[model samples]
Target: MTAAAPRPLPEWTASAVSPLDAKLGLELLEVSPERAVGRAPVAGNTQPFGLWHGGASCVLAESLGSLAAHAHALTLDLVAVGVDLNATHHRSAREGWVTGTATALRLGRTLASYEVVLTGDDGQRLCTARLTCSLVPPRR
Candidate 1:
């Protein structure tokens, strides 16, 4: 007999993702359980001082990390919820897009963690962040 077709991946529509993601102009470039990438414009996500907002960096970091965690959780018929998030701002960006790359640090049965690095267009590190998500059964 022919092999069964592979299951389809989750579709990330605007409505399916966080509304804040749209508000911040964040766009997902890549997605997987091991890694995820996203970008946001520096113009609208700036602080009052005209520098990139640290909170925005945290948001991007958590978003990417959670995305990866969710992907992993899906395989186990579970859902992921972010439990903790930490970020360190190393520098500031005033222009161009801010890119965030998330690499999985751990993907355990109960939890998932990832480290996300936010960079400028010129490749300078703007911030570093870590996120942890707890996996749980989906509500019926």
Candidate 2:
């Protein structure tokens, strides 16, 4: 992650979860220093109703925000935990991978906030999510 670039949240880390848990195959492709950008296939992320699930969006949002917060605490040796999150479904995603961009709204010493927008293959908004993370202090 470049200092000038945005950062990725902690939950985006490969170490945080197993491949099986990445049902949507959300790949954390870019961490610009304070933002997390990723992509996940619609097929795996969608629900039985054939649209992307709201919970899936929330998972992505929380992951991105948490990862960014964790990165922020690296200097002090800590992690991050999701405290609050909200997701608004704008449209359904049915046939392709969706791009998600997580932008940090706040990155404080004890807490962090991020807004994640998931766009369909055609670049239409599928969901808008916001998340907060509480920095976990290191164990002494």
- Tens-place lDDT digits, model 1, residues 9-60: 3585334468888888888877788988889999999999999999999989
Can you give the lDDT of residue 66 in candidate 2? 64
Q: Output the TM-score of candidate 2.
A: 0.82
TM-score of each model, in listed order: 0.90, 0.82
Check candidate 1 and list the clashing pairs.
none
Whole-model Cα lDDT of every candidate shown, in order? 0.89, 0.75
**Candidate 1 weakest ten by summed lDDT:** 6-15
Give candidate 2 misplaced runs (Cα > 4 Å).
Answer: 1-12, 18-21
Listed per candidate, the RMSD to the true structure in angstroms reads 5.8, 4.2
lDDT of 2 by residue, 1-140 (tens): 64674444345365864353377586787653377788777776767898788787777777666666677667556777788888888888778887888898888878878888989889988888888888887767
Candidate number with greatest lDDT: 1
- Name model 1 segments beyond 4 Å from true: 1-15
Give the clash total for candidate 2: 14
